[model samples]
Target: MPRNSKRSTSIRFRIARSTVNYFRLIYQTFNLDIFELNPTASYPEFEKGLLATLKPYRRPHAFLPRTLGFAAAIARSAKSVFENARPIPFNANQPLFVASTTNQKLAIRPIFDEMTTDSFWFDEQCKECVSTHANRLRIPFIPLVMLKALLSKGYRRKSFRHSVATYCEIHGTYLAFRLAFASSRPSCIVISNDHSAFFRTLEQAARHSNIPTIYVQHACVAEHFPPLNFDYALLDGQDAAEKYANKASRSKVFLVGISKYSKSENESRWTGSPKRIGLCCNALDQTASTIEIITTIQKSLPDFEIHLRLHPSTPASEVDKLIRKCPAGSVVRNDAKTVNSFAFCKSVDVIICGPSSMMLEAAMAETPVITVETDSNTDVYGFQKHGLCQTATSAHDLSNLIADIETRDRGAFRKAISYFCEGFNSPSRPQASSLAATLIENISNRQQIPTNWKQSKKHGWWRYSSNEPELEAETTA
Candidate 1:
């Protein structure tokens, strides 16, 4: 007994948990956010700190812009300082509920429409959001004194300025939502993304009101996403489900396929030999590096033309910057969001991009994708590790990779993209929206609440068990 007592009895947590707690502890200590609060906005800051530690160059931003935005937001909220707490503007008792992002409005629209006609939905409290769209709903902003206290506590150290400002926003917004939900009493909350601190705050307030939450996968998943802790999660396929489970997801998972996309025939663009290269760029991409990747590839493949597809959300000035700096062979096109995505994917022989869900979309379109890493740092989705696509580290590496694939059959290069999404090519399969809508409706009705992972004998629809540990069955000797 004495010999065995030498070992430590203290509990040990996983590395990721320890890392998150480290950042959370920093927030608590500096902001004095004890007893009086629980915060969710610290997630992004944790990510910034972790990423900066992992990749030194991508450090927490320089002081210039962060300070400006912090000051601006504080000043902007002053106008609403006299405003009183407002309730959600709706005819009281409608609880068959859901919430979505303004950016994802188009994708979520069909799902919402399937849920009900003439439903009034609201976006997050961002000033940029229209607040009221198709059927407008305005949620009132409530004034709070916590901002002043947080701001005062923040000036103790100039370096913690950004963190203090971020907390003020999160706490303030959370109180407003809490005030609203306490009165509204919605039975459940459904959301498309959890990465946003505001969304996480909404979930917190909903839980405070004893309301259940549902999550739908709106974009690609990676190792860095927060754990899936919603009451229910409708995932795209096994890839997303497994990733969520590994992250210790607490939800009852469902593989409802990609709710936004439907089966369609892609336009044929390849004729005789391959000629065009489509480079996809969105707001999330690093501009200088993406431009460098495209420019280098243009010079390498002189025989082929390059087309740059700028996402719709990209700024008007970005078009000018890309066009002026890029090689003459590169043509910048800004209508990517306006046109059909599948058709645009088919317009190129091979697609080149950084880590984005577009790689999976290209696979659905049956187009070959080459994911350019440019360095060891930014492969956020691990496409190469998953064998989902071919990765190139530098311009020279990318150019050589392109040369080898330029003449190869497109069919041979296509990766198994179905692992991330389900039932895209098969027209006979039911669409993800209808299935998701039915499930949502049933959940709202409090009927057939499932306990474990099971599949429908009829269509093989996934019904997951919340208690099943993802890898409980597998044990190594």
Candidate 2:
């Protein structure tokens, strides 16, 4: 080939790669899977962990007595068997997707059969589930969803391939709903959130069937969010309600308290001894800046031990590289199994990390929390807005804060934490799973959602959806 022709082909290839990544970046921003970047990480392992984190854990089912109108809404798999159920059709050439263990566990416990995004495990039991309740288990076809996504205005963007991939995922999910309710409709559909493309498609399908859809809060909704387009949003607490409830969204918000995964073991306590400082790193992209802050803190507090808690998504190799750079015996990485982050925070005198939900975790653990941010304006989880922790803008500021932590009076900090905790967590909160079950039952039983459970939409919901608006078209740099 001519040199000019070769150069043009190379440029086009670069643009295509960049376009694909450009769309992927949106999801990555919320849940940064550092492992995905590593060449050796298997997609199965990555998918499993990601699904595990997102899976809704078991909780209390509605336990109202027979005397009251509200009876228990529990359903056992054995009692609800569909032995000769027909299978939802899809391409036989494509692999059958199995429900994850997490999903399977939930399916056995909850009264309702769940419809969630597939993480690609097609086990024998799931095959049996398809055989038993084929109507509820629609096999997803990529081509159908992709085609629908390509046609929808909501899925179109400046780039073609990336948008199609995302839309297909969403549309495929919609098709599952379409198939499931072909002859029969669900009483209601309960989802973790409506931010993702899959959930959005499910929501639309449920809406079409006149079936109510509920949105369970999954993360911190601390201001600047999109309009929530759902029948209801079951929030974690008043904090989530205050931030997410709005006028334009036309969605109801219920304060359900902390999510199952976020429910602390309730063993948090401060020993009041200056020994270890826990550093929960989330600023992976700013690795050089993080290392500089760590080194400075180590130099300033030579005697104090530092326990670095890496994000679960961060690769061990990257952590190993960081460990080698830190002072030997001075800084140690946290073992996720051995060290409970909340427990670690409680045992330590103080905690340091980039602006993230970790700050809130540390605060809940009753430890003094300090955030190190390059951007002075950044306030993750409203730590600064609520005056819940200390903030450091540079390595100098972080070192100074670390040096003075011992002398600082933390009574007010603890007090603020107590107030903050009260609002964020429901008063006398029940087990998350139990609360969720009761909420679902109530909604399905035709109970009117409280009018008070409403909020003003300062931000829209598109931020977390595939249909989120695009930035001006730009190619790979």
List TM-scores for all candidates, in order: 0.69, 0.60
Candidate 2 lDDT score relative to the true structure: 0.51
Give the runs in model 1 whose Cα sits over 4 Å from its true position. 1-78, 81-87, 91-103, 116-119, 123-160, 265-272, 282-303, 311-315, 335-343, 393-415, 424-427, 449-477
> What TM-score does candidate 1 reach?
0.69
Per-model CA lDDT versus the true structure = 0.59, 0.51
Stretches > 4 Å off in candidate 2: 1-156, 159-161, 183-185, 222-224, 261-264, 283-285, 336-344, 403-435, 448-477
Write model 2 residue lDDT over 219-318, tens digit each, in one string: 5554445457678666655456555555266676555444433344554344444667887775243567667877887777678788888876677887
